[model samples]
Target: MKAWQITTPESGLRLAELPDPELRGGGATLDVLAVQIPAYTADLVAGGRGGFPLPIVLGAAGIGRVTATADDVFGVRQGDIAVATGLFRSGRAAEPEEALLGWTGIGGDGRPTPTTDRMRDVWRDGLCAERALQPERTLLALPGAETYKATEQLAFLPWLGIAGAGIERAEVRAGQTVAIVGATGQLGSAAVLVALARGAAAVVAIGRNRDALDALAGLDPRVIPVALTGDRGVDGPAILAAAGPVDAVIDTLGAAPTPEPTMSAYQAIRTDGRWVLVGGVRQDLPIPYGDFMHRRLTLRGSWMCSDSTILDLWSMVRTGVLDLSLLDIQIVGLDDPAAALTAASHRHGLEIVVLMP
Candidate 1:
């Protein structure tokens, strides 16, 4: 089987021919058709900033067809199309050769066991190969969707998680105004869609790139694209003021100092409004507790959603509420995951790329 392998953090990944995995007693194997790349996340893994294991197949999401199955209870069957999410049992837990192997959960009998963890790892491995062994937990049968690309459909994993977390943290409700900082990246753009889908009255898309901002304008008349000409820290307050008093703020810019957006979040947001931090902005900076206390603002953080949240996202996709086609996506081959990762790290492109098997 042809796959990408990250030999070491410093050495990086390469396309190699590896052994194909076999179906376990209670597992299934999918013939991978497509894989998507969140270039930004991939770069982090290559640089060792992201915590993926070495020698692991590099992918976050994908689509495949089940070719074989050892268990009928898993809801996936041979010849069924499926989409995979990679957030479960990651790192040492998801390593195929590791004890956990990505499957970790309690049994139906209400007893905790290692069986669950191993099953999850098998699911993660299935995403990056021509043929893959997928656990029941990670595979979702796509009964109706017609086309699948590594970059486009694969985006459901990261972007969907971002949108879910941002909306939850912001406590978005109908008629509320929401602002998405860095609203052009994989997570940021998804934030905009989530805001719209959830019925936010106004969604402000803020970014440093004019082209990206312009790109999002057509997606919705409600999306107001604001540009950051200067540093975010230097220009954040003014930008927020221009956008008006938003009820919620979704900050996805993962940078140091985080700009002074907290001030914008404080001044523009309603007294009870929340500020959701999805990126690593100002991670090292101290928060102004005085201002936070005075404004009575809510500050929250969001990581990838729980396993169930991911499943809900799939349902959203099914309903056609989350339009992933609006996202920038490029498809590549499995052997070329490195190039996609390199581009994502630098925030180089307006689109996300998916690696196909």
Candidate 2:
């Protein structure tokens, strides 16, 4: 099978022909269809994100057709379409460990531990290949995806599902306004659509990019674009003016330069509203103890989604509620990493780059 690999950070990312994986006790082999490469994939390969096992196949989450599953893998069988999410958990009840199967994500602290190291050793090869081997826990079966024509668009499922998980954590609902910070990015853009699909009366798409905001507003009349100027005082008021008393705020800002963009949107949350953090904002959020206690506000930190979240989002795509046709996707082959990596770096909302392996 041909797959992208990085023996070391100094070696960089490359395509290589590798031996087929042996079927293990809990592993499943897949014929990869389309795999969505996120904007920061280049960074991940350059060792900017974090450490992973050396001599590893480099790819994150994607959709694939199950060619075979271990006998113990009963949730899905052969000839099924499986959603291979990169996220994998240790299944421990107390402070369990987690690792992004073929990528840089380690535990919640973003630090690599002995446990996470062992986890990665077991499942280091990623989905950026003609075929892949994944643990059953990281695979979710999609019943009708076999006949789904738009495989490139369907590659965006991982992002959409993650965004939907954060939205669900915020308890977004009909007749309520929701605010999505960094709404111009891939995950944030997905959250905007999920909020709309869940029947939010209005969605405040807050971001620094004006053109992307305009694109989001064009998706629906209820989408109110708020361009951030960085000043929390001014931006907060602008967000509120656009969408009154936001019932929930999902912040998906990645590696933020400052927390102001997020805090500004935070100010618009309703008195009893919820705030969900799913992005890579590194700054410490200074929440006033008095105000938080007085307002009865809630805060949740959501990572990759649950099985139910992806299933629900898949249903929406199948039913045409969350339209895939609106997306602008660029599909590429497995041969070139330099061009594809550069293409993936331009963080345009709803503009995707996929690998058709």
Candidate 3:
């Protein structure tokens, strides 16, 4: 099997032929159909900040078909289609340095377990590989849903959880407005879809990409575009006024740490409304308490969500509410994972996927 390995933090990837992963005594093996790269997550792990086993196969999400399984497993079956994310609970024997690979889950005690921390490992073995040794519990059975485009589903799965989970935290209501900053980015784009599906009366999409925002106008006329750049100023009240009242703000970009538009969203969100941020913006920085307090606003953070949340997102995909076809998803091969990472790092394009060769 040809696997893409990130041997060092600074060095690029190398596609090398390695022995195929062996099945655990109790788990199942899957022949991967597609592997989606959560490029941003991969970059974070490769940078060594994500606290995962290094040089591991780097992927966080993808879809595949089960090829073989242990007799005791009943959650998933041979030839059944599934989407795997987070981490594998039990599988391949761990190497000295690879013990941290399958730990991406949040444990019962509320601590981030192996499954939560090692997202890159989860992506690589669970989602990106042509053949995967997946614990039955780690794979979600996906029934045939014509609404789900396989390629698009692979690209959007991880981010859908990120965004959909944020919406769930916000508890948005119908006849209410939601603002999505960096609305054209992968996570932000997914948030837009989820917000509409949840019945947000209006979606105020804010971003620097005119083309991307313009493209969204045709897909769903409810998205109101607000173009914001650092050099030029944005009037928060006016933008929200134009969108008519803002009830919730979904910020995928952090203005204090990375960009300035996030600050605008803070000011625009109605008092007592919610602002759910998933992007790495403004984590440690001091927020304006006066503004936050005046509105009695709820500031919340969202993680990848529990397994049940991912299943709920899959349910949305199974139904017609969340549209994957409009997203910018491109599937690539294993030999060239860097290009996808580059695009995601620079925010130059949409979802970049590296599928099994």
Candidate 4:
């Protein structure tokens, strides 16, 4: 089997012919169809985002058909189409810690752990190959997925699951207005569709790209795009003006050197409204304790999604409540990961990049 391997953080990705993965107890092997290289893959590979012990395949989310499964695995059977998000449970679902399949992605605290080598044997490999191994718990069956002619869209389920879980965590109810920061990106776009599907009276799409924001607004009349001015004080008012006082805000902006944009979103929230952080913004936020206490604002953080969350998202897609057709997907081959990574980094609007193994 051919796989893309990174020997070290500084070493670039190379296509290597590797031995097929051995099926472990309670595990399944997937004939990988398509894998999406996240926008942050390049940064992760180049050591800009700390280092991971290398000599590993690099990919997180993908959709594939089950070719083999251990006798103990019953969640999915041979020939079933499944989605893998690179997340798996070790001890129990109720346990505080979980294992991410690709890199040292995220752990118990819903944050990436500093120890890059923890679970190195399990997470050292990912879905960037012809076939990949995963615990049965990480595979979710996607019945009739082929009929949709939306393999690219199906590749986004991992992100949709994450965004959906965050929206759920915020307790966004029907007939309420919701704001999605960084709405032009993949996760943000998913949140917008989920909010609309869940019956949000209005969905505010906030981002720095005017054209992308405009494209999102074109998807639904209820979508209101608020272009960021990069100034917290100014952007806050802009968001409020467009969406009015939102009932909740889901921030999907990636790691930022400063927290101004996130803070700007914070200011747009109404009193008692919830602000959920699901993105990679790395800076520490300085919240006014007195203001938070008086306004009764609730701040929460959501990392990855659960299996139940994935099922809910799949149901929405199957029922056509969450339209996957709106996304513009770009597909590439595994031979050109650098080009794929470059394209991923410039992601905008509903454009998503998928790698075909």
Best lDDT among the predictions, by candidate number:
2
Ranking by lDDT: 2, 4, 3, 1
Comparing 2 and 3 on TM-score, the stronger one: 2
Candidate order, TM-score descending? 2, 4, 3, 1
Report, for all candidates in order, the number of backbone clashes.
18, 0, 13, 1
lDDT of 3: 0.64
Kindly list the per-residue Cα lDDT of model 1 for residues 2-66, writing each as its tens digit: 87765666666677788897888756777777665554555355462324334566555567778
Worst 10 residues of 3 by lDDT: 95-104
Determine the C-alpha RMSD for candidate 4 after optimal superposition of all C-alphas.
2.0
* Per-residue lDDT of model 2, residues 168-261, tens digit only: 9999888889999999999999999899998999999999888889999999999999998989889999998996889999999989877788
Instruction: Provide the lDDT at 143 for model 1.
Output: 60
Q: Identify the runs in model 4 with alpha carbons over 4 angstroms from their true place.
A: 92-95, 109-118
Query: Which candidate number has the best TM-score?
Result: 2
Q: How well does candidate 4 match the true structure in TM-score terms?
A: 0.94
Better of 2 and 4 by lDDT: 2
lDDT tens readout by residue for model 3, 170-227 = 8888778888877777678778888888888888887777877776555677878787
* Local distance difference test, each candidate: 0.63, 0.89, 0.64, 0.84
**Cα misplacement distance, residue 130 of candidate 3 (Å):** 1.6
